[model samples]
Target: MNLTQQISEDMKTAMRAADTKRRDAIRLLQAAIKQREVDERIQLDDAAVVGVIEKMLKQRRDSIVQFEAAHRHDLADAEKYEVSVLQAYMPQALSDAEIEEAVSEAISIAGAKGQQDMGRVMAQLKSSLSGRADMGKVSSLVKTKLIG
Candidate 1:
């Protein structure tokens, strides 16, 4: 099933199981997806849905960091729960080694040389690695590869 369909089914399941936390998280995801559709006036495909999920996950991670930095462990833990819920829909994340391999391949494919080509390398990497690996780490690896 497509992500939207899967999420809908999961939402029903969550309701049937009386899973309040999962239900709320799934509802939040649905709201985000619906809001995007209304704003853009276009239905999102699975990839677009995945993009939305990734965006939500990033927001949760940022919130977690901010909460922890402010010494709010309770808030941080709450954000972590949200993150876990959102992560259920994501594909298995690529390992560091896998990410590095992909980065190397992207560099070669883009013919990236020196720091001047960082933008091009980054664009390729983003397209190639989106939803699979952390862009921040991928960027650092790209810089290291280009410089060293």
Candidate 2:
């Protein structure tokens, strides 16, 4: 099944299981997907849905960090749960080694030699690696590879 269909089925299961937190999380995901579809005037494929989920997860991670910095342990913990739920919809994360390999490949493909070519390399990597790896880390690796 597509991500959207799978999510709808999971939502039903969450409701039947009386898992309110999971159900709410799924609803939140659906709302984001629907909002994007409405705004963009296009139906999102699974990849697009995954993009939305990844964006939500990133926001939750940032929130968790900010909450913890403010000593709001309870809020941070809640955000952590939301993050976990959101993660279930994404592709498996690429390991550091895999990310490095992909970065090297991107560098080669873009013929990137230095910081000046960083944008081109990153654009290539972003299209190819978006949900599979953290772009921040990938960018760092690309920089070191190009410079060293």
Query: Any runs in candidate 1 off by more than 4 Å, and if so which?
Result: none
RMSD of each candidate relative to the true structure = 1.2, 1.0
Q: Write the per-residue lDDT of candidate 1 for residues 1-148, one digit (tens) a residue.
A: 8889999999999999999988999999999999999999999998889899999999999999999999999999988888998898987889998998888888898898898998998998887688888888888999999999
Clashing pairs in 2: none
lDDT for predicted candidate 1 compared with the true structure: 0.91
> Backbone clashes per model, in order?
0, 0
lDDT of 2 at 27: 93
- lDDT by residue (24-111, candidate 2, tens digit) is 9899999999999999999999989989998898899999999999999999998899898888888988888888888888888888
Give the Cα-based TM-score of candidate 1 against the true structure.
0.94
Stretches of candidate 2 exceeding 4 Å from the true structure = none
TM-score of each: 0.94, 0.95
